[model samples]
Target: MPRADTPGTEAAPGGRLRWWTELPLILLVYACYSAGRLLVRGDVADAVDHGLAILRVEKALHLNAEHPLNRLFTHEPWLGVPADFWYASLHYLVTPLVLVWLFRSRAVRYRAARTWLMTSTFIGLIGFTLLPTCPPRLLDAGHGFVDTMAHYSSWGWWGGEASAPRGLGGMTNQYAAMPSLHVGWALWCGVMLWRFGGTRATRVAGVLYPLVTTIVVMGTANHYFLDAVAGAAAMGAGLLLTPYVLRCARWGRTRAVARFGPAAGAFTRRLTGPGSPVAGPVTGPVAGPVAGPVVGPVVSGGCETSAGERFPRQRDERPRSGAEPDASPADTGDGAPAPAR
Candidate 1:
């Protein structure tokens, strides 16, 4: 397909199939999921201790999940309270929905896009391993943010809790919150779409998605103020790193074109060579040089006895006779005589 007026920088993307490149991406995604599960499920030792301690210290300073403002709205007897499933659903769907949309759209550069998405996701997950901060809902059971996964019934979607149930991935890392992948991925989605979104509608969609995601995590007690900030930081890191990623992509393509371009050009040139069926200056014969004239001998072939009058063709090249010219050379013209060449 032709490119849009708002072009993508994905020009000259090589002929690799989506599936082939997607292989490593799939593996990386699974690996990230595997690692995240392990981290979330296992104990975060000093990590959580420090995280909860921060929550404690923040609590002393009136910064906590159950801050007075939060307590007012989430007053006791709030239905299906902590781990608010309704809000949590938004968090889960953000990534999946955006992925599906981009895949189905008419955008160029999806392969590079998907690769970016996958790589950034794994990198965010790796951060989850290195710095495991607890969510506000989990920081000290009483005031820790709710584990919305623990809430089943009041989900906006019926099978909501079922999402996390059946141990979606074993060893769930519930407390790895220093850099929230939830926010990081959401921010990634926001940036990717914001950068690529051509239409006003698309750009707005990109901008709103992360803002909504932030609220969902906060309302569900899944992250802290700092988690969102940390996630934003992660996004900043990814953005900084993207240029290198794109540079590698560009270098790879430069090599591929150096390898393949001349071959294709040579092939095209050969197709239009001397014997080609098409007619053009380079590939076809001229009209056998421009024709000058077509004078010829009439069938009355006679030669002169004494002298034959020869015409250097007529000045206008009309045939008068093939008979020999009169030796007398006198015309019976009453008015005038035609001039001889």
Candidate 2:
């Protein structure tokens, strides 16, 4: 049997989530989003007009059911308090927990999931900035959209205004409600869990989580039905755009390699150890035979019979085929043939 620590086992923490790596980036992006929303707050008059326009559209479509639903939930403290709590807490809690879970267990999926989430969130932020639609609870008193969180303030730390922390309500952008990120993020969590989860119960919870979130946001009068639809639409757009984003990133890397490959290769060669092509086999001038004439004994035979003598002897030093020994007086010095002229 394979050991638990071996590859593919749960004990092998290969792709485990690195909080130090991901947390700061996630926090930075979210902070920028929050600040950007606040910075782009539209004029109150325009925001109210936009909200009223959405209400009219919903009414025409017979989907302006938020008013009745909000009234019903707020009229009863029992239902309204829990809805308020869900609104304030789950919006911040569930999505992040799901993200952490994905990062840890489903790390291969974490990047795409995170891309869809961040993309959808930024899209929703752009909508909020360009067309700040006020929430139902923020409409004029005659609209009958009770702010359930306000009515149930005593049950939680939320102020009698929006769901911001008791004193931090001023920091929030109340008019940026057109494409509700709450619904969009909830839907992302739901879809990811449904797709990647191992159990039937998990799949069911995945579906229920988003549906319940939709209800909670609507029941609390925090978002219009149309706002929820816009949120879902934003998520769809994100899912569609993520693949192109990844492809562009890959193309960028390929271009970078094409641009810097030669220099990178030279650097790699410099780092290579000895005996590698870059570092081995020196080739240059060395001690070799001098390229000039020779001197000394001129024997009849081509063989010089002397040390350090060059081969393929001089031209006139030829040996005749049927000739007898010379016995000449010059040859008497060593009994060798006379020198060739």
Q: Estimate each model's TM-score.
A: 0.58, 0.70
Can you write out model 1's per-residue Cα lDDT over 101-126, one digit (the tens) per residue? Answer: 55456235555566566556656677
Model 1 CA deviation exceeding 4 Å by range:
4-12, 16-24, 36-42, 56-73, 76-88, 104-106, 109-112, 142-163, 166-171, 192-201, 249-341
Off by over 4 Å in 2: 1-18, 251-341
User: Candidate 1: global Cα-lDDT?
Assistant: 0.56
- Model 2 / residue 162 / CA error / Å: 1.8
The Cα error of candidate 2 at residue 60, in Å, is 1.1
Supply the TM-score for candidate 1. 0.58
Among these predictions, the greatest TM-score belongs to: 2
The clash numbers for all candidates, in the given order, read 14, 0
